[model samples]
Target: MTLLEKLNQDMVQAMKNKDKDTLSVIRMVKASIQNESIKLGKEHLTEDEELTILSRELKQRKESLQEFTSAGREDLSEKVRFEINVLEQYMPEQLSLEELHEIVEQTIQEANATSMKDFGKVMGKVIPLTKGKADGSQVKKIVEQKLK
Candidate 1:
């Protein structure tokens, strides 16, 4: 099944189970994807585009949770964390540091990333390879250290 199909099934399951938090997050994801598709004049998004939306949503949730915790709003933080956990259930398993490093190194070599100027090229290659499986910021930091 496609990502959309999987999401629809999960949404139904969440509704049947009365999982309010999960249902909320899943609805938010579906809406965001639908909005983006409308913007692009498309009826639906590809799996890759769906992953991009989900990844961006997860990143935003992590940042918001961090901020909430830092501000001592434990209740808000906890709710955000719960939502994040629900959202993350759909993400691919994250790669080990070793695995990410290996991919970055190989892609850098393959793309002939020669200097800091080649960061974009390398990142473009790396993100797709590591999509939903690693933190983009962490991967960028590792790749930058290796390249420089």
Candidate 2:
């Protein structure tokens, strides 16, 4: 099923179960998707477009979670953590660290990237390959380590 269809189904389930958190998250995601479609003047988003929106949403929540934790706002951080979990359900399965490392290594070799100077070349090639499956920051860390 399409992401929109899945979201609609889950929204209904959340309502039936009286799951306020899940319901709110789903509504927000739906709104974001709809807004993106409207902005782009398209009735339906491509899979890549949808994935981009979901990834943006996930990134925002994770940044908020990090800020909250650093600021000692445990209550807010917990809520953001839950939101992250909800959003993750819609994302493609994440790559394990080992898998991510392997992909980065391969990309580095393909790009002939040596040392930090070829950081951009390696990252440019790697990001598209791992986009929704791996966290960009984590991939960067691994690349930096491997290059060093």
Candidate 3:
């Protein structure tokens, strides 16, 4: 099933099972996605747009979790973590380290990126290929190391 279809299915299951937390999180996600579409004045988002929205949501939750944890607010941190887990259920499988390494090599070659000065060209190729799969910061670090 597509991500939105799966989200709908899970929403029904949450309601049937009387899972308040699950239901709340799912509703929040649905609302967030709908709001995005409304902001765009569109009937539907393309798959890439949807993935971008989901990734942004997950990143926000992760950052919130970090801030809460650093403040010793375990309760809030756990809640953020729960939301992140729920959002993650719909994301594409993350790229493995080895997979990222291989792609970085290919990107380097394809860009003729001989030094850090050519990092932008390398990243231009890498980002689209690794979109929703690899972490941007991680890719940058590896590419920088390769260039150096």
Among these predictions, the greatest lDDT belongs to 2
1-148 in candidate 3: lDDT tens per residue?
A: 6567778999999999999888998888788888999999998888888888888888888889989999999999888888888888888999999999999999899777899899899999999999899778899899888999
> Where does model 1 exceed 4 Å of error?
none
What local lDDT score does residue 68 receive in model 2, on the 0 to 100 scale? 100
Kindly provide the TM-score of model 2 when superposed on the true structure, using C-alpha atoms: 0.93
Give each model's whole-structure lDDT.
0.90, 0.94, 0.88
Question: Hey, what RMSD does candidate 2 come out at?
Answer: 1.3
As a whole number from 0 to 100, the lDDT of residue 33 in candidate 1 is 88
Q: What's the true lDDT of residue 113 in model 3?
A: 84
Count of backbone clashes, every candidate in sequence? 0, 0, 0
TM-score of each: 0.91, 0.93, 0.95
- Superposed on all Cα atoms, the candidates' RMSDs to the truth, in angstroms, are 1.5, 1.3, 1.1
Question: Compared with the true structure, what per-residue lDDT tens digits does model 2 show for residues 25-117?
Answer: 999999999999999999999888899999999999999999999999999999999999999999999999889989998998888888999
Pairs that collide, model 1? none
Using TM-score, give the best candidate's number.
3
Model 3 lDDT on a 0 to 1 scale: 0.88
Between prediction 1 and prediction 2, which has the larger TM-score?
2
Pairs in steric clash, model 3: none
